[model samples]
Target: MPSEQPDGRGVPSPSQVDVVVGGIKGMLLDGTLGPGQRLPVEADLARALGVSRGPLREGVRALSHLGVLETRQGAGTYVTALDPALLLAPVSFLAELQQPASPALHEVRRLLETEAAALAARHAGPQALAAVQEALDAVAGPGAVDPQVFVEADVRFHRALAQASGNPVLAALVQAFAGPAVRARSRAAVGDEGALARTVQEHRAVLEAVRAGDPDRARRRMGAHLPAVEDPLAGAGEDPDAGPS
Candidate 1:
């Protein structure tokens, strides 16, 4: 049975998990809980939130999985560093499961990647640019013909580009879409002799624009590149037996 307070209110009750979760979230939003700060002792926190220990622990576990909290052995739980990439890990998994890519997801990727390319051009330093170039070169190397190797390199190139944008959130967003994007490209590349070559060329063009520090050119190149990769899957979501246009 739930515990009751004197005022006819339920103490440590009424959706205990939600109450606990909301209490923690409220604390976070109000600056009471900052990144890397250790949470109050469990018993103390539970009492403060008017929830039982079970629900409080469960809520904490949930937040930990979401990358909003971190638990250390014998050190107690603390807020995570709040890195965008860490926070978006679950989002990446969800994006990957939306097989073949949906129009909305593609649109999101296009917008984010286009901006990332421009930012990369303007802000990417020598080291970051070199990483992008390395990924690009890997795609055009001897093993480029291998589908797995080619796709891996392709994903890496985009990832590097996103990182070079100097926005961790943007980079994480790009990575979230990468899995489905790779699958779409991989499906299109199968038995298509020109597909791999075209992809390498397109990536080269984008890289060249970024290397030249031309933001407009980089954005345009990326805008053009995504469609080329996605076009082959145009009707992928339509009737399975429908004839190709």
Candidate 2:
């Protein structure tokens, strides 16, 4: 291992791991490394980055977790496709940690989903529209209405709406925000027939606007739906006194 030293100009360098990370990132941005391209062999890359193998390996691992890189068995590390959905994967896991629900999460959904509904109205194709309809049907389906059915259908309805928005990143964001609030959402919906009925009616309105391809109406319907949806979560247990963080 080379001794960690100043750049010989009196300025201390960043940590070796950071050096490796930055070096790889620079290469990526400058087109030296590209999607699906395997990185140079470890020994060569280590020398080129002025870092030891340990830092290089750690950097690769970090990048992999970020969806910036992938390791192939017996092949080597390579850059990933850099898809928005892939890169945003961590947001879903982090959102899960919110648990019982956070008012802030719901607020974010309100904002994003209103715009997403508008976008869906503008861009949804037949197949996408059908998927949304299926989710809604599942919600308002048959004789026995399971509370869990509402929760799952609710999640799917929003997800399908987002996907129909024709923005992968926006869809991913909406899905992430929705996941963490499920527990509280279900808590309030279960055994509440009125809540169930209200939810079905609201979803139908949003779907109607979206199906009609009216962006403005879709946006308004979604804006209206989000608040009604979150009404239960507040009482379900996310600290109403604490306010939205």
Candidate 3:
């Protein structure tokens, strides 16, 4: 494996193996590494990242766990299908890390979800519309202030709406970002006051625009709804305590 120690020249550490792996992972996340594209030969990658073959292999294995790449006999490694569900496996792993600090996943989630919400408004079908209404009803009906139940409904609501966008990959991305604490913190931030009430209204706006088949309106409405959730994260510097729950 590549040494984790820094080189005498004070180069960016001798952890070239991790560097290679992280480089490849970053490429995948940024869409530079697409599914079905073969990776360069081990020697080539090693030279590029200034690492040896041993650490390179370890890096590949780590990304494989995230479903980001695959190796074939004699054919070498290739990027896996750029499916959202596949991409999200690492999210469960990341979730464990969140309990220790404020989760940064919400930022990623907000990006995907806001996009999904906009798309759902444009592409929603009768069934999709029904799902949105059901979720909204769950929030509005009696005994709605229960945070846990409301949180569950909220997840279902956003997820269902994302799926309605007719994009499975996008839906998966949304789910990965929408971690439990992020949801809970959002609820807590808004509390049982007008914030919750505003959420219902925003969701309704998204649904109504979708029902009307107005993609632009849907997108705008969805975009409008995100500020309230995002504001706190902006002030909190990404890991600020969600405060007790």
| Clash totals for all candidate models | 0, 0, 0
Candidates' TM-scores? 0.85, 0.85, 0.57
What RMSD, rounded to one decimal, does every model reach?
Answer: 6.4, 5.4, 8.5
Over 1-245, each residue of candidate 1 has an lDDT whose tens digit, in order, gives: 23423445634434677788789999999999999999999999999999889989888988888899999999999999999999999878878877767777888988999999999999999999999999988868754377787778888999999999999999999999876786677677877777777778778888999999998888877877787557753332232123322
Residue 113 in model 1: lDDT: 95
Count of backbone collisions within predicted model 3: 0
By descending TM-score, how would the candidates be arranged? 2, 1, 3
- What TM-score number comes out for model 3? 0.57
Q: Could you tell which candidate, 1 or 3, scores higher by TM-score?
A: 1
TM-score for predicted model 1 compared with the true structure:
0.85
State the TM-score for model 2.
0.85
| Candidate 1 deviant stretches above 4 angstroms | 1-14, 142-144, 233-245
As a whole number from 0 to 100, the lDDT of residue 199 in candidate 1 is 76
Task: Determine which window of 10 residues in candidate 3 has minimal summed lDDT.
Answer: 236-245
- Candidate 3 displacement at residue 122 in angstroms: 2.9
Model 1 lDDT, residue 103, Cα: 76
Whole-model lDDT, model 1: 0.83
lDDT of each: 0.83, 0.80, 0.70
